[model samples]
Target chain A: MIELFSDLFSDYTLRTVAMGAALLGITAGSLGGFALLRRQSLLGDAISHAALPGIALAFLITGSKAPLVLMTGAALAGWLGAALISSVTNRTRIKYDSALGIMLSVFFGFGLVLLTYIQRNPDANQAGLESFLFGQAAALVERDVFVILGIGALVIFLMGLFWKEFKVLSFDPDFFQTLGFPVRALDHLLTGLFVIAIVIGLQTVGVVLMSAMIIAPGAAARQWTDRLGRMIMLSGCIGAVSGVGGALISSSIPGLPTGPTIVLIVSSIVVFSLLFAPNRGIVFRKYREWKSGKQLRVEAVLVDMYTLAAQHLSAEYPHSARVLDVMSSMSGPARRTLGLLKDLGLATQLDAKMWSLTPEGVRRAELIIQRQFGGEE
Target chain B: MEYAIDIRDLTVAYREKPVLWDIDLQVPPGVLLAIVGPNGAGKTTLIKSTLGLVKPAAGSVLIHGKPYADQRVNVAYVPQRGSVDWDFPTNVLDVVTMGLYGKLGWFKQPAKKEKVAALKALAQVGMEDFADRQISQLSGGQQQRVFLARALVQDARVYFMDEPFQGVDATTERAIVDLLRDLRKRGKTVCVVHHDLQTVPEYFDEVMLLNVRRIASGPVGEQFTEENLRATYGGRVAFVSALVSGKK
Candidate 1:
């Protein structure tokens, strides 16, 4: 572990790759909060896949695989794909999900065809371009890291500047329209930012799994808080951690890939949050239900004991364990409940077989009965 | 006299089918007007068009003798409770503060003064204690009240509320009605897309009975009658007439 830490700090390639992945993670995670809240998770998937044709076309046009040119091309193509999906759903009977699916396959398939055509050339540099499909984090250099940082900073700054407008947009676009906001313009701006964030990640995470980088951090953060501001901050943190951790682990091991490793780390965070976070987590909900169930069982036994005393017209009337169990009608441990009542001074055991209510128990039972039946005779 | 709101030849369509047609209306200042119609009667469409949320096929909407765009600062809208996702990650205070976003303009954050105003609006709705509480934790009635408080913070001269009483409890309904009356007393024009016909005469000074087209729009005592209700509701006249007579 110490050797791995030293290598992470000393190895220049690992440092550049790790920094690039972390920057991509922060921007993608922050933007993903908006997408997740808007119920547009699939749109992220579609946009990333749709970016491929642009990346390929950028290479075709420039013939030089510069990061800036390729990213610009990728951004344009992703934006066009998003616009097409919106227009198709808006103008025609096609639903959003179907439009997204259609765009994803067509754009990605076109990109693959273009990629194959490019591979036919005898250029050695073209060999690594296909890595944009699954990503090759190891190929990232200092220049690429600077590009990622610049784009990521711009995205995060835009998110903060338009925080209120975007919040209103996600919560209620109709009301946002009524407020004289340029709703359509704001929407396109947000989509452009989302596309930028995705485009920047294509080199580190690739198109196929970039959506997971976009969505998982936000989803995990959502489980931990009920405030958008906190959720966004936490998502950025989770994304950063996952990015650095995945980069380190993948570099340390020979066979593991960085992108999938990042996804795996983030997915594990999501799973842990889903099971253990307070309020909305599954484990917490189950514990609450179990506690309520136990309380109900105890109340049932108390009510049964009270009913027996009422029928006999005396608080000192003793009833057998069998009679109380039969009256309670629950398949619970009746004797254990009776012992709990005795411990609470609500009931007293006269002998091994019979039990009677204490005065405090009588009063408690009467209150419960009154509440259940609204004080009726 | 310049009316608070004037809509001329307003027509709105969804997917090539008109939802509201030839809707001409002029609401006077400081009057509480209720727009009553059955389900699918374009009640919501009327409000949306007046606020420029929906693009009209052919029409114009003016507030205070000016186009809606020119008079946006003078108008505030409260959509139906069901229009927004209640489970969104926001506090009551933040949701209420959104009413001030237009006034704050672009790229400017809300400050201490804005927070104070939001808290004041919450107090008006008796929700000051729940300022920090997440919105989804609120009850349906509380949620409706919070929406009302948001509109209150806008401090606009004209307010449009769409079905403010739908799904709210009795206390919230009374609170909203009281708030409407209070707004009118302050010389503000308030128009509500109301569903309950029984309370129309009690809650509104004027009524507009609408289907796809306007049936009648005048003082409740003069224009709200069985014939116009029949024209608006089509087959629910019997049920509506019972409510009308029951009110009498």
Candidate 2:
């Protein structure tokens, strides 16, 4: 087992697979922050599916899997799709969501038909092309890793260079447009960058699952914090972990698709954060509300007892309390609550049966009653 | 002297359907102009066209005697509240700083001067205390105030606001209007897309009544007559007036 582990690490193919997925994951994670914030999570799905014709056209022309040709074609097609969505929405009455749905299906369908044709032709080495549909990260070559690294570096550099524009456009586009900031041009540029990230992801996560890579980590990071800078950084970290985890799990076993496995890993992180994070998580919010509600109810009961004791002006009374002296209704918990209040020193037991308010308890109860009467407002 | 903003025969369309037609208007400097109209009356589209956000099918707009594209640095815009996602995990300070992004250009971060400007803008809008709060936690009025602060940070000569008072509390509406008055006093030109007709004569010195066409434009004393109001609002006025009268 030790020898096998060493062999796996040293093997060029395995190393390539790990490196490629890691790079794609990091890039997707970085860009996903903006897409998620812009409410354009489906943009990745659109771009990834749109890259199909580009990949097929490249293969048809070159008769080989040349990374540059395929990537350039994919980027062009993706850019076209992004531009088409914008133009169609701007010029026509069709909503952006409907436009995207139309573009995604049409492009993917066309690509699939072309892919089938290529597979049936005389000259074909298209086995790897199908891997892009579900992603076989275990089969990544060194060239694939290089492609991922180069594209990832370009994306990171562009993000840093245009960080301010992206922030402005994403936050308040109207202000950017008024400033004559080339809003449409900058938008197209960013869309181009988004397509680059999605295309890079396509080779690792496949078309159907790329949305998970683009959204899951960002969504998870969002639940943990409310700062954009921190969320983006955390998203990148989460993406890196899942990328490595997916590669490890798939490589360890046969017939496990890497794309779906990676999605599962990222989704689990989201689920964990959603349930367990301290401030904004679902479980924590519900728990806090429950605990606070109990405290409020107890406070109400103590205030009721104090009001009754005030009416009597009695220094001593039996521990057992009656309800009619206080306003109207009473329940079982009210009685149990009075007993607990006496034990907590909020109330005093006198003559072995009745209940009276402590000096401190009387003041606290008076404040609560005043608040309930709208005195504070 | 050139007017603050001027449009000549400005006709704009979406696809082939005309949205704004034959609009000719001139706004002087230091004037608080309110553009009022019913829903889908091209209130937003007019602002967008002047800001160069949309291409006009015909005609032209000039700012400070030059086209908006040439004077881009001198203009600031505050969009409608609904245009942005409030749930975005950005703090008030972060959103305010976005104004400087356009002036600072690409690749450069806002400097000390820019930070001071942003904080000053936030202070002007009375949002300084909530500078670090997440945008989602803000009330509708506070959110509008934050966007105003963003426009303020631009330090531009011309400011255009789209439905700035929408969903704002009465106090917030008062505060934002006062801020606009302050801007006008400082020799800045402020144009707002206003929805409430009752506040028209009280809030704005100049008014532009629109209904996909240039119905009228001038000071409230001259152009805000019943004829223009009728043309702009159409039959909806009878129903709207009932609600308007019921308020007082």
Candidate 3:
């Protein structure tokens, strides 16, 4: 582990790749937080897949694999895809989900055709163009790192400047409209930013798995918080950590891919949060239900004892275990409840067969009966 | 007298199907008007059109003798409770502070003064204790109260509330009625899309009976009658005669 840490700092190539991946994670995670909350997670998937054709066209036009030129082309293509989806859904009877699916398949299939055409050519640079399919972090150099840093900083800064507008947009666009905010412009601006975020990740996680990078951090962060501000910040941190961690692990080990490794790390965090987070987690909710079920059983046993005492018009009226079982109608063991009641000084066991309420137990049972039935009995 | 709200020949259509047709209305200030009708009566569509949320194919709406766009700052709207996802990651105070966003404008954050104002609005709705609580943690009644607090902070001269009393507890229902009356006492025009026909005369000073077109709209005592209700609701209102007779 110590050798791995030292190598992360000492190896120049590894340091550059890790830095670039970290920047991709931060921007994608923050913007993905908004997409997740807006219930547009599938849109992220569609947008990422839509960037592929633009990347191939950029390579065809420039005949160079430069990150800046390719990324600009990718961003434009992604924006076009997004615009087409919206227009199709808004202009026709097609639903948003169907439009997204249509755009995803059409754009990605065209991108593959372009990629195949490029591969058939006699160009040497076309060899690594397919790396953008699943993202080769090791292919990123210092220049790519600088590009990621600049774009990531700009995206984060823009997010902060429009934070209030975006929050209202996600929460209630109708109310925002009533308030005279430019709802359409803001909506388009957010979609444009989402396209840029996806464009940046095309070379890190690639189009195929980039949506996972966008979604997992936000999904994990949501389980831990109920505030948008906190969720965004935490998601960014989760993304950055997983990005650098996956880069380091994949570089140290030979065969593991960096993008999938980061996605796996983030997925594990999401699963852990789903099971362990306090109020919203499944485990905590089940535990609470189990505890309440036990309390209900105890209350049922006390109420049954009170009913038995009432029937005889005596405080110390004793009933057999068999009689108490029939009266409670509980599925669990009656003896277990009796043991619990005895521990609480609510019931006394006389000799072998009879069970009766103590003075304290009678008072307790009366209080439970009154609270449950409003003292009607 | 200057009308607070004036709608002239307002007609709205959705996908070539008309929802509201050839409607004209003039509402005076300092009155609580309830727009009551059965389901699919375009009650909500009327409010949405007046606020410019739903586009009217041919019509004009004016507030204080000015177009709605020019008078946007003086208007506030409370949408249906089901319109928003309650699980959104925001606290009650943050939701309430959003009411002031119109005045705050773009790229500006709410300051300490705005927060204090939001808290005061929450207090008005008896939700001050829940200022820090997540919106999803609130009960249905508390959610309604929180939404009211949000609109209260807007401090608009005209208020449009859609189904504020729907799905709320009795206490919240009474609280919202008192709040509406309080708004009227302060000389603000308040319009509500209401569902409960039995409480129309008791809660509102004026009533508009509508089903696609306005059947009748005037002072509650003069316009809210069995005949008008029957016209608005058509054959679906056989039980309204009994209710009106009981009131008599």
Residues A1-377, candidate 2: write the lDDT tens digits: 46545756897766777778788888888788888887888978888888888888888888778677777777888888888987889778999999999999999899899888887876647767777777777777788788889988999789878887887788767667776577778887877778898888776677778878889988899899888778887887788788877876787677787889999999999999999987989899999997786677668777666655666755233335555224425434565666667777877766545667787777777778878887756
Q: Give one digit per residue, the lDDT tens place, for model 3 in B1-248.
A: 89999999999998898899999999999899999988888999999999888889999999999999999889999999999999999999999999999999989999999999999999999899999999999999999999999999999999999999999999999899999988999999999999998998789989999999989999988898899988988888888888787663
CAPRI-style docking class of model 1 based on DockQ: high
Interface Cα root-mean-square deviation for all models: 0.8, 1.5, 0.6
**Model 2: fraction of the reference interface contacts it also forms:** 0.83
DockQ winner:
3
The chain B TM-scores of all candidates, as shown, are: 0.97, 0.94, 0.98
Error of 3 at B237 (Å): 1.5
* lDDT against true structure, model 2: 0.82
TM-score of each: 0.95, 0.88, 0.96
Q: Where does candidate 3 stray beyond 4 Å?
A: A313-316, A330-335, A343-345, A348-354, A373-377
True contacts kept of each: 0.80, 0.83, 0.93
* Cα shift from native, residue A44, model 3 (Å): 0.3
User: Model 1, B111-185: lDDT tens per residue?
Assistant: 999999999999988899999999989999999999999999999999999999998888888899889999999
Q: Which parts of model 1 are misplaced by more than 4 Å?
A: A320-345, A348-355, A358-360, A367-377
Give model 3's TM-score versus the native structure: 0.96
